[model samples]
Target: MNLLEEFKKNPGFVYRIGTDYYYIGKWICKPCTDEAVTDCHAMYEMCIQAKEPANAALYFQKLRAYSEFALDIPYNPAKILQYQTALVEALSDADIQSLTDQLRHFHDQAS
Candidate 1:
């Protein structure tokens, strides 16, 4: 069975092709797409499990930095752009295409 079929049979399955991550037939990336927001969240959880209060606080702060709901402050446009630049700079052309495909799929579903 292929990755897609594996995901369909088990929704919880996580597939990785090198640094590329796929879940439920969708491509996902870190620090900008589906990972950072939860990357921080997962780190925070780990801190909690490790009983490190200071580290937990730091991770929580990182989590909030990526999300508006965690705080009332609006995101800085420059910072957002910087993040976009970094993400795009780090990805190859094929990676960008994968991300674009994911975005199109999301928009199509929303429409």
Candidate 2:
């Protein structure tokens, strides 16, 4: 069976972003141009509504990380810009830099 058919049969299957058959958990749909953008906005809203700044910061960081991992194409100008913007808005400079450094180190080691 094709990816869409497989995803339909098993809703829990994880689907990576930027693929044709991006799973929304319950079903698979064609790639949506604003999927990531919508996710970012939703997360941002949730963070804003959070009672604690710490919780807000945590979720914001998660959103930023997900965006980075989902958009792996460095050459894609739009993704690069979106990732940078999300990183900046979601984290303080020091924290974001620290996380970036740590991630880079981990990636280097894995390679």
lDDT of each: 0.42, 0.38
Clashing pairs in 1: none
lDDT of 1 by residue, 25-87 (tens): 212212324575555655655676687877866765554344333322353435534543455
RMSD of each: 13.0, 14.8
lDDT of 2: 0.38
Top model number, lDDT: 1
Residue 18, model 1, lDDT: 31
**Number of the top-ranking candidate, with TM-score as the measure:** 1
Full-model lDDT, candidate 1: 0.42
Error of 1 at 29 (Å): 11
Q: How close is candidate 2 to the true structure, as a TM-score?
A: 0.30
